[model samples]
Structure formats: structure tokens, C-alpha cells
Target: MTEAFIPIFYFSGTGNTWWVGNQIAEELQERGCQAQPISIEQVTDDEAHELIEKAAMVGIGYPIYGSDAPLIMQAFIENLPAVTGQKPMFIYVTQAAWSGDGAYFMRKLIEAKGYQIRWAVHFNMPNNINADLGWIITMILKLFQAKLPHAAERAAKLAQHIVDNQPWIMGKSSFLSFGWTQRFFFRKGFDSSHKNIWSVDAEKCTSCGRCVRLCPVDNITLVDGLPQFGDQCNICLRCYNYCPELAILAYKRPYNPQMFGTQPYQGPVSEFKPEMLIEKK
Candidate 1:
């Protein structure tokens, strides 16, 4: 047999994880491995289990949310197939900060599934669109400068880690993902309870439909010249994040206050389109 290899996968929301997923998949192909990209966004538990049942080598890619895994990716890992034997699994993470404990969290989740994790790495991308002024300004720039060189460099470096089969930090990630900081993310400030859910001023909306078009999840509907949000928000924070009128949030984006003074990841602005992960077809 050439190699019974496949990367049964993930990566959702802002496409940071998905970008890492694509870069890894491309590298695996270049090494002559048959790799596939699986999206966890619209997938069901049964579908996830079915894919795992057929694969020996697996890769689970995701963006860290609140220092833990994204709610959706964690749920998928929780429902992953109960492994019959030890399997080699690879993990990839995409994040705005240098702090995501990707492999440590992956090892915990996969041990529950009865698999042995082989290696993993963190791939830094520009911060995802957030309800921050800098993010909005940077996003508009990305529309014109999609192929930023730094993003490609980060993606390539992460891809090299996978093909070279090197250990990526072992378990240092546990200190952060399962650490005290995870508790702080839920502590009042970053949580939804503290979120400034968008409000329409009614004086300047202009029924423009820009927010609706910009929303990744279609979470908003303009009702009589104002946007309405009913509970279904990915909280990628994009609707409010990229709003042009400065009408998106009365305050600043809730998560990061120091963003104005620092570059979160080691990169420049780059656009990530969600639909590029159709490697299955």
C-alpha cells in the first residue's frame, strides 16, 4: 500500500483555521499523500464519525476561541469516533495571538477518542475581523491586497512543520488551553454577557444593506432602516466588525483593548475566503 493516509478535519468561522487546513493539505499532496479537507461547519456527528472510521492519519484544524477550542470544533471532537486502535493524528491551529495551546488541547480531545497524537503547530494569521477600528480599516485594505506576503510565509512555515514530521512543542499548550486564562475568557469581559450587542441609532442607518451583505452568517436583517440581531451570531464579530458607518458598535470590540498598539500575530492584513475549502469535490 502506498500509504493509508487522510486528514479528517475541521476549521470554521473566520477561515483562519481553514487557511491552515488548506496549506497543510497542499503540503501533504506535494509529498504524494492523498489528503482531503473536511469542514466542521455544516457537518453532523454521524458524518464526522464516518470519516474517522475510514482514516488512519487524521488532522483536526481549528481556531482557538476563548483560549479553548471553538465551541463547534470542541463539540465535533467530543463526538469523534471511538478509535479501535492507536492512530497517528496531526493538529493545526490558526490564531491571532501567539498563545493558542493547539496540540495540548488536541491531545486531550484525541485521547478520549483513543488516538495517539503525532505532532502539531500554531500558524499565525492576521487577526480575524473584529469590531475594532483597526480591523475594519485593515479589512478594507485586504480587498485590494489579498495576497499579502507574510500570510503566505506563515502558512508555508506551518506546512513545512507537517511534511518534515517534527514534534511541535509536545504539550506546552496545556498550560494555556486548560489553564487559568481559559477561566478568564469567560469571566465577564469577553463573554457574551458583556458583549455590546449591536444597536441601531435609527438616525443614520440609511437602509444601506451593507451590514447584511458583510455578515458571514447572515445574522442580520434590516428591518425598516435598522439591523436586527436575534441570537444566532458566530461572534466572529464581523457584522459589527466591518461596518463602514462606524455605526457597528457604540463602544470598541469587546475582546481586545490593546489591539491599537500592537500587532497580534506576526503578519499583515490578508483576506480569507471561506469557500476555498471545497477539496472534497
Candidate 2:
């Protein structure tokens, strides 16, 4: 029988992971393997599970949040239908800095669903820690422009390994391992206590409602032309990074034009339209 297809199931907050998934899919197809990249937000759990069952190989990619896996990704992995046997899977993470134990957590989650992890790697993209701090991230991205191409090159190399049917293992990515630094910095800085920390300044807000539409969790609602925040935020930072008016504030901090420096992921190679991720209801 011909080899089964490789389906890459990915979750991207802005677009970094999406880019990685698309690149991998392209390389696999070029090497004569059937491949498809699927977005986790656009599919139901049953649909994702069926894709896994029918695939000869699997790939899961997502951005690292709080030095841990995104809650949405964790939920999707947990809800997967039982597999008859272990399937070869590849796990990749996108991070600005260290990914902490995120890869380890993902490996465990996938194994729990009876999948054998063939690779656990990471892609270091531009940092998007606090979208409210866009200016800082902007400066950082400038310094990283010289090094960003390295990430894309590395992704191409990994794709070749898959095309060759090579068994590879890149576990607990560098600077991403669980340690005291991750606990003190990301765990504390990104804790759930900050769920209500976001505030919108009515004076700066133009009632554009961009935050309402960009939020992945539907946590923002427009009330009387002003945006309101809810508890469903995954802290993806889309609303804060993409806001044209700079109206959204995180941690109750005042919006400072000088200090704002966020470079959210924007280089998606695929033809995927992000607006389709929005729920129609």
C-alpha cells in the first residue's frame, strides 16, 4: 500500500506556528509524501481524532505560553479518541525564549493518547511576551532579524528528515527546560490571577472592535461601542498586538507609545485566512 498522509495539526496564536506547519507540509509534499496542515481551532475533536487515525504520521505544533502548553492545545489532546496502537507523532513548539517543560508536557499528553513521539523540537521566533510592550519587542525583533532566517532553515532540515522516514528525537529543547527561572518568570508573570488584569482606556479606544474580533477565545465583547473583557482569554496577546488604536492595556499598565514594542507573528506562508477562525455564533 502507498504510505499514509502526514497531517500536521497546529495551534497558532498569531501566526508563527502556522508558518512552521505550512513549511513542513510543503516540504513533505515536495518529497512525494501526502501531507495536510490543519488548524486546531477550525476543527472539532472528533474530526481531529479521525485525521490522526487515518494518518501514517502526525505533527502537533503550538506556541509556548507561560513556559507551558497552551490550555486549548492541552484540551484538544485530552479529548482525542482512543487509538488502537501507538502512532508515530512529531511535536514542535514555537517560543520567543525558553519553552520550559512545554515539550515534555506535550510528549506526555500525546503518549497518553497512545502515540509514539518521533521528534520533539522547537522553533525560536520573535518574542511576543506582552503585546502591550510592543516597542520593546520591536527592538528585540530588529536584533533578531539577522538570526530569524536560521529558524526557517532549521525547519526545512527537519522536514527533510521526515521525508526520509528517519527517526529523530529532539527532546526538552534548549533554554526551554523546566527550571527555577521558568517558574519565577513565566509561571508567576503569566499566572491566571491576571485574567482580570486587562483594561481598555475609553479615551484611547476608537470603538474599532478589532480586539473583539481578533481575540481567539471570544473574551472581548463590544458593549455600547466599547470593548469589554471576559475570563476566557488565553492570553494569546492578539488583541493587544494588532490593535490599531493601542487601546487595550494589560496588567492595568498605562499605554506608553515610547515603551510599546510588540512584534506579533505575521509571516504566514499558507493561504489560510485567520478571520475564518472566528466563530459565527
Candidate 3:
């Protein structure tokens, strides 16, 4: 008799973590485990609790922002109620530029809530989403300025890691340290200090409200016919990352034109993970 093992959960803004989560789930299932994929977008507290309760081996996946996981993913994990059952957990972090000790933090928080941290891994994917247009330009310039073919190299290196679980020897990519941002984010990203993290560019914005509708948490609104974001922004930056016109700035950087998907993903290996897709009996 075989046991049905379920591993589910991830937070993706601009679809990076979502992509990565699906890959990890598939890999687990390929090893003969029953893996499930769950998105943190539009996540409700009650639903999260139920999923966490049912997962035999839970996986928490998110992108690396600065030195930590996305604010939205952090909030989701913090809100989960303590489960009576014990399960082995894996913390996965998907990133393009920099990744901090995301697994380290997750293990700490989950342990506080009474759970076991079985393993952790930091994996890099392609930079599908850029920080801002200004940042896009900056990265392009840097890409050309530096003679190194960093993208191609990173992709090759990450793919090998995925297939063999080998350690990557690439240099560090994180721009800032998580220790600097941890204290404040643990409270919430919507606090006064984090308000400016997501802002609209009036000149670039056409009042489409795509950001408003696309936001899983309903954090944006229209005030005076212009999009006005409330205090609760999770800073997923999906508004800007997925915007048709690229109107949102993570801080003040312009949206990059290259954000059109040339970069190799730092998240999931592929869309469906081929192996994880569940077919009807």
C-alpha cells in the first residue's frame, strides 16, 4: 500500500513563484508523492487554515524581495492558525536577483507556530518581471556593460540544480539585507513605511483599473477617477508587473520594456510541470 502525500502552497507575483511552486510539486510527485499546487493570490484566511491543516508535507514558496519573502506571502503564513497535526515542511524561495534566508525565516516562523522544518532551498529563475521601467533600463545597461553572460549562465546553472539538486556556484544577487527589513515587515507591509512601495504613475496610467481587478487582495481603488491604493498594499507589485502599459513603479523606477518575458524564469521550470497535472480517472 502506498501513502498519498500532498504538498501544496506558494506565493507568486507576476507568476514567478507560481511557476516555481508547480515545478516543486511535480518533482515531489515524480518521486511517487501526491503533490498539490496552491496559489497565495486571492488567499483567504479560512481557506489557508484548511489547506495547511490537510497538507501532509506543506511547502511554502515565494519570491525574494530585498532580503525577505514577498510581503503578501508573509502575511498569509502569519495568519495561518496553529494546526493540531504535525507535518514535515519544505521552504522554497524563487528569485531573479537576490534571495535571502527565506527558508531560514520560514522555518523560524513555522516552528513558532509548532511545525517541523524538514528542508529548505534557494533557487534562481529567469528575471521575467523587472523592478521598474527605470530599473529595466538600468538592468539592460548593466547587462551590456558587464561582459558576463549572466542570464544564460544562470539559466543553465539553475536547470542543472533542478534536475540534480546540485548546489549553484553563482555570486549573490540580493541588493539589500533582510535583517534590515525584517522588524518592520513582520508587522505588515501596509504600514506607513511601506505605503510608497506601490504607487501609480499618472502620466503612464490610463485609468484601466487592471491593477485593481487583478489584485488578489483587493488593495487598490479608484479615487477621483484615478487609481488610488489603500494602506493595505502587500507590495506584490503585480499591479505594475502585469500592467498592460507598465504604469506602476515598485518605488519610483520606470517599468522595463524587457519585462516582456525574455528573461529566463527564476520560478517554476514550466507552465504545467507536465508531471503534476492531475487527469480525471
Candidate 4:
């Protein structure tokens, strides 16, 4: 019999979701399933449709931001082609703390498109925000590393459930559903802005165009060798965390670079390269 083919589409801001997706894929493969982890940023709409059409099951992974999936992942889910047979699907999310109904929110969205959500899991990962916290952040990252084995074991269990056709659902409480409102307000505050709140320190910027290349939504562009930001920012923090020189400046409001300083994170894995997320044309 042919092995089941599963494609996991995931979005990672600073590598937490990417690492989890890879772990799940590896576990699934070890269980005699053909699993591939595809970056949401890299997959074209037609390519996504083709993969979903042929896959035995679909997986979605992302990091929780403000108790919700990132804007990029939400858009990807919204644009997905509706399936007729209610294809089985699973979801996983990585977060630093409680995600409330993050997984459930995504389940409802996918269900609206005629997908049956078979399983949903959440993993707590190292906090990517508040990088400027210095030593406190270091301790948190150390804790994440210490718990790595347990996380991997959980991933294996998730894979095993898939292999056995077991149903596991999480974050389904009615009380937790308040996270949907939180997500709505969060998106309205950050995503509805017509003004750009991203900038670069010209002196620190090397004109390397890394930010332009790494932005998942193509909201960054090079203008005369300097990176310029558009109003379509998803606020994923990929460019800010991956910037080599800490040149990228993000403000809570327009024209306020001093509001938050840049402190680039090196990602969860030592060998992670920002360019790896870029789609090869």
C-alpha cells in the first residue's frame, strides 16, 4: 500500500513554528508517512491547491501572536480553496504562554472551508518578543532548550495519533473563545493602520536587502539601496529579528523609533538561515 502523503503548511516569525513543523514532519515520516513541511511564505496559491488536493491529510502550524495566528497565516487560511469532501486536517501552534483559543480559532476557520479538524496541539516555546529584556530572555531560552526533549516527545505522539486515526482536540472551551475577541481587537489595532511604523537606521543598515527578501508579505522593498516599508505590514518581526545589524526599527506608533529598540534573535536553531524561508523563483 502507498504511504499517506501529508503536507504541513507553517508560518514562523523567528523559527519556533518552523522547528515544531519540522519535528512533526520527521516523526510522521518515521511512522511510514510521507510528510513535507512547506513554508507558508514560499507556497504559491496554485501550488497550495495542488498539494491540498492530493494529500491524505493537511497540517497547519504557526506561532501565536497576541492570542491569535499571525496575519499571514490568517490570510492564507482565508484564501484557501474550499474542499467538497471535508478533508481531514490537523493544526499545531507554538506560543510562549497561554494561547487561549488560538488552536480552536483556526479550527473554526478551516471548518468553514469544508475541512474536518482531526487534531490540534499547542507547544510552548521560547518567547521571541521582548528581546530587549537581556538576561531574562536568556534564561527563558535556556528553559526552552531544557524542555526540548519533552516537546519532541509530544510531537511524536501527535504523529502517532495521525497514524492511528485518533481524534484529539484542544482549546475548545467556551470561556477560551474570548480569545477571538482579543484577536479581533489586536488585528484592528495593528493591521488596520494605513501608516507605516517600520523604519531603518540608515547608518546601521548595510543595504543588504535582507529585510526586503525575508518579508513574507513583500511589504518591504528596496528604494535606492535602502529598505522601505509599506502599509501592509503583518508585524511578523522576521526582518527585525533576522537583521544582522539591528538596523530595522519598529515603533508602536508612527515616527517613534525610541519606543522599542532592536535586538535581533538568532532563531531557535543555530543553523537556521533567514534566507531558507525565501521562496526560490
Cα shift from native, residue 155, model 3 (Å): 14
lDDT of 1 at 168: 58
lDDT per model, in order? 0.60, 0.70, 0.58, 0.79
Can you write out model 1's per-residue Cα lDDT over 1-281, one digit (the tens) per residue? 12556764875555666666776677677766677777865566787677777785778887655555655566677777878688778777665654446446557667777887767666656565544546676556345323435556655665566556665553364455553466366444446643355666565457777667655456789887788875555465445444545465534333343653332221232564434333335
Best by lDDT: 4
- Mark the regions of model 4 whose C-alpha exceeds 4 Å error after superposition: 131-146, 192-196, 252-263
Q: Clashes in each model (backbone N, CA, C under 3 Å)?
A: 0, 10, 14, 0
Candidate 3 lDDT over residue span 203-245, tens digit each: 8788888778766567889886567777776666567655767
Comparing 1 with 4 on TM-score, the higher-scoring candidate is: 4
Instruction: Write one digit per residue (lDDT tens) for candidate 2, span 1-281.
Output: 12558888888877778777777777777777787888887788777778877888888888877567676787877887667578778888887765556555656666877888867777787665444445665566456432457677877787877766676665455554543356457656656465776888888899988888777767899998888888777777778766777777776765555443343334443354456444432
**Candidate 2 ranges beyond 4 A from true positions:** 1-3, 130-146, 172-185, 254-257, 260-273, 276-281
Q: Summing lDDT over every window of 10 consecutive residues in candidate 3, give the lowest-scoring window.
A: 272-281
Candidate 1: clashing pairs of residues: none
TM-score of each: 0.69, 0.83, 0.68, 0.86
Residue 206 in candidate 3, Cα distance off native in Å: 3.3
Candidate 4 to truth, TM = 0.86
